[model samples]
Target: MAARRKANRILAAVLVPLTLLTLAGMAMLWPSGSKDGISLANPYSAAPGVTFDTGKIQSVVEESCMQGSTAPGQSPDTGGQPAPAGSDCMFAFTEPDQGGSPVKVVVNPEVAQSHGVKPGDQIRYLNLSNAPGAAASQGSPAYIFVDFVRTLPIVILALLYALVVIAVARWRGLRALLGLVGAYFVLAGFMLPGLVEGKPPLLLALVGSTVIMIGVLYFAHGFSARTSTALLGTMFGLAITALLAAWATDAANLAGVGSHDATTLINTSANISISGVILCGLIISGLGVLNDVTITQSSAVWELYELAPGTSARKLFTSAMRIGRDHIASTVYTIAFAYAGAALPILIIVMLYDRPLGDTLTSAELSEEVIRTLVGSIGLVLAIPVTTLIAVLVVKATGVRTAGQSAVGVPDEDRRPHGTSGAGAINADDVDDTGALAAAAFERRSRQSTEGSADPATTRRGRRADRG
Candidate 1:
């Protein structure tokens, strides 16, 4: 325990100062405004500039579906006329953002289910100087469908999610959400700008991720031995993840520029390394789940110790490993299934190919997913045991409870069956003589730390003193 405290003091003294310095440096170094603007790599035009305006639909002129050689019931060659009843619609709207002058636009009927715009609905649109028709170019204005201002639904959904989280997990959930906001700010404000300015993606991601993990672990769970243990494990996992991702990217010859967005980024900015950015993404992607599993494992070990405080460190380790095993079983599938779900469309397309299953899996896109999944899973799986081992050592070090409370992640309602809650409910045999076991374990650890066993007479004297 003394040794542990000394170590913590040293770490805090070093890390706290270092972190502050890093933040100060970041604030000074990061560019605020660039002439080019922020983008994936560089700004590439996905959509041409169109005049954006707001309006409310005043009258529903015509709503119909187009079919046959002509659109709806019109000919494009002779300037489109009114379409069928099932085709798109032409509407007159009051331009509130533009001096309230009434204007007209055509809304595609196909997007009705998705957009749900109707007469009297307020929306924003893009007014084109030259639409398809010569009439628009000549004199009339044409508006393109943009978006409905649905802030209420978005606000409601956000509130629902927040309520659900707070109701179930209470304070912890709130803190976790705060941590998420901090993570977002760091990624958006610091990491992204640095990446855009052509800083080393891997290094920036690594440092930013570390800062995020530190804040998230401590903020969400509070500063304690258990959180510290999990954090150490998380850092080690991140290092392993970064290294593996680097190796895999190189070995697999993954350029990470196959996607349309990546291709656009490459064309837009020739400076950014798509592959390096992908490697950085790979490192960042595993961080959340990696933190998740490590924290869980650390908490499980602490819970095991609290349940059977007298149990030997080895026994506690094995017990925690049992829980770790179950978590691993569920989580490995989580990573695999998550990637599979994301790539479902590609998987379906691949299935239509004339290739065998092995060949299909070995394709560029699919293989990238596989390698990413494997790398993340490897780091995650390894983190559990490391975290568990660390937790056991810390929790058992002085035979004293650090928090004097249940594990952080395991809620009070979940520690045992319903209507049962003390420290925990476990077989008495599992605990044995907790006092004796603690003393024995402490004695053994003390000898290991000092590199020598205590005298037999001193041990007997200590026990007698305790009895007295």
Candidate 2:
């Protein structure tokens, strides 16, 4: 009991001040909570309000859209090379908010194929003011050409994912889901806005993710020595991940602006550093899985000690490492396969390239993926052992025992490795742990109990002869 309190005091002493400092730092560096940086608009372009929101296609007509064109039953084309502008294309759409109210719009055949639209399709409209004297009023509604509506599908998927997780994991899963929400809050609230404001993306990622680590692990796993040990290990792994990401990014000459989206972002926001942002993403991308590994290792160590309370620290460490090694192996494969699956399209393109394999694989796109995988793998692999070590030490230090019990001392006879030669080969100090001594005492007790029982050979015969 006393030892457990001492451990608690030590952990509190370390974590309390750390938490206060973290809060202070976060308050100082938190973003303005404004989204202006990311919501960039071209000042010369059309107003945002003029654009149409999402709507559903109501009806379609095959009649001519041009002036002085006949109805659909009459002949609209002669040669059939290409249909005229006002020929065979009209669509009616109704906004979701305003049901049963349909708006008609002409579709240009030239650009008609570019944006395919049919009846019952969910789409976004471009409110063009083509009608004569047509204003932005209901009587003269703007032309509602179709784009796409992606909102509903994504929302449905998110809800489904949440249901499955909570259903399977129950309470623990509920906490994990909440932790995920908190993590997303950190990313969207801090990391993203920080990047938009031209803050060092790598630094922002490290700080924001570390803060998230503290929250997510403790919140999902609970606040205790076990969770604290996991949190420490995760933080250490994140630091390693950041360092390795930086080193690998520069080493591989990763421009981080390889994709079209990145190029567009850079052109629009010249202040942003694409490479730095990519490196930041790289470091944080490993955080979720790294947290998983560290936490599992921590829990494993504690649970192992709980099951075998009399085991020495050395035995506990070895058993925990065995689990860690398996986890590391499986996790490494998981990382590799996951990255490969995401990059499969790029891999196909690279495979099609006629250049040598080395040349094709060293391209900017492939190199970024390579660097992300390798650096993340290294950090994850190291985190397992590091986390295990910390957890084992922690549980041993913090665990409570009954009177005359030991956390690091197993039975004296149980200390030797299996199949070891006679006792002469083993030293007394080596086999002198509480575990061994306990086992020896237990054996003595069992022998005494057997001897104290009435002798089966004498009881019946002695009684019969004496009575005769």
Measured by lDDT, the strongest candidate is 2
After TM-score superposition, the amount by which residue 320's alpha carbon in candidate 2 deviates from its true location, in angstroms, is 1.4
lDDT score, candidate 2: 0.70
lDDT (tens digit, per residue) of candidate 2 on 91-135: 554444455455555455644666556777776666555444444
Would you list the C-alpha lDDT of every candidate in the order shown?
0.69, 0.70
- Candidate 1 structure quality by residue, lDDT tens digits, 44-118: 222454467777776655433232112223434424665444544454444556674566665655555554466
**What lDDT does candidate 1 reach at residue 220?**
94
Q: What local lDDT does model 2 show for residue 54? A: 61
Clashing pairs in 1: 64-86, 64-87, 64-88, 65-86, 65-87, 66-72
